[model samples]
Target: MTILTVNTKAFRPLGVGMRQMIALLGALLGVMLISPGALAGGEVRVTVQGADGAGVEHAAIVLRGPEDAWEPPSDNEATIDQIDREFVPPAISIPVNTRVLFPNQDDIRHHVYSFSSAKSFELPLYKGMPARPIRFPQPGIVTIGCNIHDWMIAHIYVVDAAIHGLTDAEGVWAAADVPAGRYRVEVWHHGLDEERQTTGEIRVEPGTEVDLEVSVEVASRPAPRRRGTVPGYR
Candidate 1:
């Protein structure tokens, strides 16, 4: 009789423990429902190209998240250096509401100016790093040029997304930690001349790889002056 009583007590505890386990699992399920990205387990790779059947390098690739989806990174801001009277790289990407550092690495001063829909601010002639950074709060392409040096020009495309990248020298890029779902990918290159841009609808699944190729019309830009032109000369 005592053994039977003990067994009953042990069974009671076991049943209670099982109920607790179920409750815990339910809580976890609820969390997963509330935040799908938390449970997303997958990877994706993307490759970008330019027009003329040639690879485009240093271009910005932005991935827009689906509606009612997780938030993406939106920090658009980069530095524009004036070195040897030339703009380094000549192009950069920045997220919205970002501050771009403009440090004059040259021996002379530079008057930077941009006329774009996005935020525009000019840095007076100064040598070395500036006292303040320029903040680009809008999402648009800003053309930067030096008043002192008309030959010096650069571009900054302010964007909004965490899933963005710059093409390497080989015109190739790979984005990781991208959730498994539908996304709209945009590729922008300075060389692309098309007014209407190209976009791709991609369904990214976990542990799967997706390859993309984009062709954009290249704008005709004057060849960069190798050496500073002599004063009073065309």
Candidate 2:
């Protein structure tokens, strides 16, 4: 067996952008130690709710199986579009090292920046489309904002897991065809005020449905006060 050694100690902080990059490195290390062919097949369903007992949409659900559970997807480059002054989907999930496209479909210009650890970048004042896409080389939560518009914000989650999905408007999501075995699951949301997390081991067999419910307490939002430039384009 070949051994790969990584020196994370050599890396230093260059602001929040490093968060995504660092997360990517951590996830890659996890992947290297995992053997993909050792897992059995199964399915999983996930749901998220607000403190008021309402459904939360577009939240991220990540599943990390055992080293022998399943094969994880290779890190990919991803994209996020800004159209009509809004960030699309409002939230997204991607594998480490994915490149994200920031396309502007609106007539106005936008300034994109992230203060989050997973990754941070700036698409300084641009319109129509950007000259190039931003690349996320790390794994973590990236909260994107429009410098020109305070109300506009979006989140990108970089993870190193075999199965992941975003909740729809109904706050429902599923990661199907998961190999049967034990796994570590995680869920994240913008509305979650504090870090909400739960850890459990579950066994899934072919065609069996596993139901999971997660709770998150988010800071209350004041009734949509028509604020500065409405940020979330799409």
Candidate 3:
């Protein structure tokens, strides 16, 4: 069992109320739930490419074993930064039940909200960090948008795989130290023509490199005539 202890004395002086205290405790629990798990696995690399054979950045990767096999989340908390009226990193992949923090670095305020079924939340217009982080208790895609700026958008991928990560600018995701066995891989992109795509079972051998490539059909995004020229872009 996981025990969450809060320093009541820490918040006592701040005049933080009961509701805020509960949110703080929930965030603490999210951290505990994602502690590293027991997995004596080998290394695995995944390469994600678009239809045109271009590196697909920010693609969510999921590798799993049998149906009964599973692993705990890899990290406790993550940040989705807001800069230049855009969501930095555009998209991110996190383990289920991860708490995310959004800090507005821009001078102007933004009202961030998401109506996705997995996690629905609205952070009223603000300029700095919110009172508490938003906790995602379910596994699914959460679409984030700014009410003030229609162009401001982002996606969060919450997965239940044994191990999960996002592809780099090179369309590559390297998963280190996974058990040497057959595992299924799944890839997701916010621009995908479909919800997501997957690869067949890949056999991982001890002391060997396993390379796999995935092709996804992502909708094309038109480029702006010039920077900060979008209708609602600042």
Name the best candidate (by TM-score): 3
**lDDT agreement with native, every candidate:** 0.63, 0.65, 0.72
For candidate 2, the per-residue lDDT at 57 reads 78
By lDDT rank, best first, the candidates go 3, 2, 1
- Candidate 2's clash total is 32
* Poorly placed runs, candidate 2 (over 4 Å): 1-40, 68-75, 193-196, 219-234
lDDT of 2 by residue, 1-234 (tens): 011111112112252235456556768876433233322345577776666666677778887767743443544656678866678757788876667788887788888899777786788898876887677767677899888777777888776665777888666787756776666667777655533254455566644557777666642232442334355523
lDDT of 2 at 136: 73
- Estimate, for each residue in 76-184, the C-alpha lDDT of model 3 and write its tens digit: 7989999987898688888877889999999989999999888999999999897788988788788999988887888999887757888987888987657668777
Q: Which stretch of 10 consecutive residues in model 2 shows the poorest summed lDDT? A: 1-10
Q: What's each prediction's TM-score?
A: 0.71, 0.72, 0.75
In candidate 2 the C-alpha lDDT for residue 231 amounts to: 52
TM-score of candidate 3 on Cα atoms, chains taken together: 0.75
- Where is model 1 more than 4 Å wrong at Cα? 1-44, 68-77, 193-198, 219-222, 229-234
Runs with alpha carbons beyond 4 Å of true place in candidate 3 = 1-40, 67-75, 219-227
Model 3 pairs in collision: 41-177, 41-178, 41-179, 42-178
